[model samples]
Target: MTTNLLTRTHPRDDAAPVPPVRPHRRRRSLGSRIEPYLMISPTVLLILGLMVVPIVIVIGYSLMDNTITNPTPKFVGIANYLTVLGSPAFWGAAANTLLFTVVSVVAHMVIGVLFALMLNSKTMAKVPRAIFRAIYILPWIFTASVVAVLWRLLLDPSGVINYLLESLGLIHEAVPWLGLPQTALIAVTVINIWSGYPFFMISLLAGLQGIPSDLYEAARVDGAGPIRQFVSVTLPGLKPILYSMALLDLLWTTQQFTLIWATTGGGPLGSTEMLSTYTYKLAFNSYQFSLASTSAVLVLAASLVVAVFYVRRQRKEERR
Candidate 1:
């Protein structure tokens, strides 16, 4: 038996059959590598077509004179930019934009944070909280055009607001809130504040909820009063959200056009004229398309600056 086993070849000792190589391995790998890009290609193309192309064309037009209106536009180099920069109207519009943006953003933050705090309070019942939230958020639900029209009616000389003020003896006569240069900017800023605060409130409320309960407990155990706890714990937890929201608000407020356009029409001697209104007047009213394009580019540059800060902040938060 031993002699027979030694003579027989074991299956393990036999030469194994070689499997055939997969011809499609390289193709499969290549497809795998390209799949993500193919999936994103539509979005990329859409952005390029819609955003990138328009921006490039605007930039190009900014460098030329009498663009769009003239068949053969002359290349004016930096002359258009220089002209826009040198204009007092542009400077005035810029100053108004700055005031509008700064005031709106600050008010939005204060009101939003305060409302968020009220909604997030533990003593508040859910039903009342919900009711107040709905009321507070109503402004944000209205479209810009709707908001503009609504405010215009309310601020009219014979409207409800003036009637109330007159009845309260705050003013002897009805005031045209949107008509006079003195109060036009203030009225629009207030309107913008009302429309914008709800977004901040919603965002900050979400941020408040994300704060760890343990942190609050620790603060309480340390004998921190409500004010102290808020100062140390609540504010710290909300800092990141506040920073991001503020930057985003800056960008949006800077580019605000629709509300300003519909409300005051940058009127009453250009009291409420913004960069947007200024650009619109340049292009359509003055027929200075090239100059308007330059202004548009300048606005884009400012927006980009804010966007860069926001992106960097997001990256820092992600890393942390």
Candidate 2:
């Protein structure tokens, strides 16, 4: 009985005792944890000083009647906005801007995806692929002014393209590509597509290369053809990249002005007029700074709408 009681009462004396764990270091307060912000203080200050302050001033000016010739500014409430909304020119510009954005973005995505797929092929050597990639990006690296001038030359009646086409009996006469409204729009859209697709191609190629080869192999093993494999595997994998690139392209193409201004100057009876170019003409040529500001605000609103829709769609996709 004594042995039994001793064994039960004093069991496992050689076993180690559990040590108490020290509590994790407490997180610093919001202000105390702001060292990163301090490190980037110069950039933050520069943005606020340059960008944010000017935007705020523009917002104020947009709310008032302040023209280029007017020395005195007056707060006219939403009158500027009303004027912009009532103007047929504003609607025309907005329509052109939207049309350009849609067409260019669609073309960019289609062409970019195709080019990326080609580059991603295993049959291409690394050297040739690199050379092709560099060549594709060369157009994007050119200054906008240079591209505009180059296209202007190309679109001229007796330019190399027209000469070649006429010599080949492809046309009866040299077409004034930028002089006519229809051709002008087409020329600008094509130039934008050519200049913009490289960025999308590079981004999409990276995304495609990240996708595991096993997915494609598995699809093939399951008796999937090329089209079927692309539909089932590639499309779903590239969803995020597509969404991001489309939104970026939409925003950029809608605001394009340099190429338009340098090429058409919103000419051919205002057919090529976009919001950005329209705003510039109003502020500078017509000396209507207030109206220009209002136009700019409208552009900002449209961009915000596009962005909001994209974000909502992305969230819906995520939920699904």
Candidate 3:
């Protein structure tokens, strides 16, 4: 009986086990939840104010014939959109943009992959690899405006490139790269490729690095040649990254303005006039704000479509 009494706990053991103060705990939990929202609110507001609000204003303006000179804005209700769609100049600009974007992206992918493979090679010494990698990305470090201006100088009749070509006996006459309509598009494309490939190189190299060596080893063990192995193993592994880079590069190339502007200003008979250039000309040069707004909306829509495709592709890749 004494042992049982010693072992038995009192009716209230060690004072009542404290129930957490419900109100104070609830308040603390609420505060924790609210803190995250508070931290993000500023960024949310900035995006809404800067990006979303501007886009909304552009859309609204697309429906109105608004001008800086005019005090009143007349509602046109899709007239501006139709005008952009029907105009031959707009069509020409669209074609130019399409060609520029497609060719530039293709070149970027090919060159980016080649550079990535070279840099990622096990045979490459670290110092040389690092130096070459830095060189590849050097052009991208410069602003587009600076690059455009520099290239404009280099492509002039007596400029470095033409001089080099002449010195090499490749051409008898100094070819004006940005002056001829035929060469103007090609020159700008080359410039875009040079400036843009670095982005692809960085992304593709990172993707290549993420791939497992075991896969390559297995391919080799199966008697696969380098080309076959690359086609079979490397390409498949890098597919998702390639897709993502392709979409982003396409969009970026579509929006290219500075280089074309600073170099040729979409000139040589409007042969290099991209949609971005066209929009700029309409808004500022032609003082056609409504038309520019319509063009801007078209660009936005195109971007949105590409983004949707990218999202769907990502989902598919994730499943795979």
Candidate 4:
């Protein structure tokens, strides 16, 4: 009986299979999880070394009286800022900067919107529209120096523009386009508008294209006229893009230097001298680095104010 029981128990145990062992799970440390940031360490270092360092230096220098000829910089607290604030030249430059930014941004938006609308029209030929867009963008692609030189040539008394005008009996004498103060300011403003409008046009055109054609079709079916559709649908759709472009244009125009420098050199009794040009002249030409820095700080403050206002307006509109 005992032998039989042992044999039965051994058979039952043999029929049962062994369970497979579970593999061990490896735990990742915090450093391993953040390895991606480690991979981009070089780029972060480069930005800090190149961009951040220079900006810090500029900020430091801005707080001190560092003349062009001086080897050492002396901290003068806020005295330099007070001097710049009190200067009539600074006020004039500030006014001119504001006028330039406002006029250029307004003109850019109006003209750009018109062009984008025309280009977005179904009746326009694709090839011709593309050519027109390319031509308009050419001015923006050209170097600032080249554009300045071209404008200088065109605006000169003996240039083709004046000669053609005189030949057509449009004028008895060649106008000194850049010689007079008012004319010089107008000329600079026109150049700025021309150079800047194409960028805004392209931006608005992209925004226009992003809008669904179905919306327009629906509007049409609902008895919405073109004017009504544009006002109610298109304008609202383009509001964000328009606001962004306007702010960008304002900032760019306010800080414009190369074109103005190459074209007018802030001449004709500083009539065309915006804040940027004024700051440059103060720093390099007049050897007043601290004062220049003060002006630059003011320019930065103005830019911040404009940007903040636009952002707030955008947020309010979005909430509604």
Local distance difference test scores for all models: 0.95, 0.88, 0.92, 0.86
The TM-score leader among the candidates is: 1
Pairs of residues at least 3 apart in sequence or in different chains that clash in candidate 2: none
Ten contiguous residues with the weakest lDDT in model 3? 7-16
Q: Across residues 1-320, which tens digit of lDDT does each residue of candidate 2 receive? A: 99999999998789899998644433455556787889899999999999888777777878888745677888898999999899999999888888888999999999999999999999999999999999988988997789999989988998988999999999999999989987888888888888889988999999998898999999999999989988999988998889977987888888899999998999889989999999999899988888888888778878898899788878987897
TM-score of 2: 0.85
What is candidate 4's lDDT per residue for 199-280, written digit by digit as tens? 8888999999999889999999999998999998899899889987787778788899999999889888999988999999
Q: How many clashing residue pairs appear in each of the predictions shown?
A: 0, 0, 0, 0
What TM-score goes with each of the models?
0.93, 0.85, 0.90, 0.84
Estimate the overall C-alpha local distance difference test score of candidate 2. 0.88
Report how far off residue 20 is in candidate 3 (Å).
9.1
lDDT-based ranking: 1, 3, 2, 4
TM-score of 1: 0.93
Compute the lDDT of residue 312 as modeled in candidate 3.
94
**Candidate 1 ranges beyond 4 A from true positions:** 1-19
Taking every candidate in turn, the Cα RMSD to the unseen true structure, in Å, is: 3.0, 7.8, 4.2, 4.8
Specify the poorest-scoring 10-residue window by lDDT in model 1: 6-15
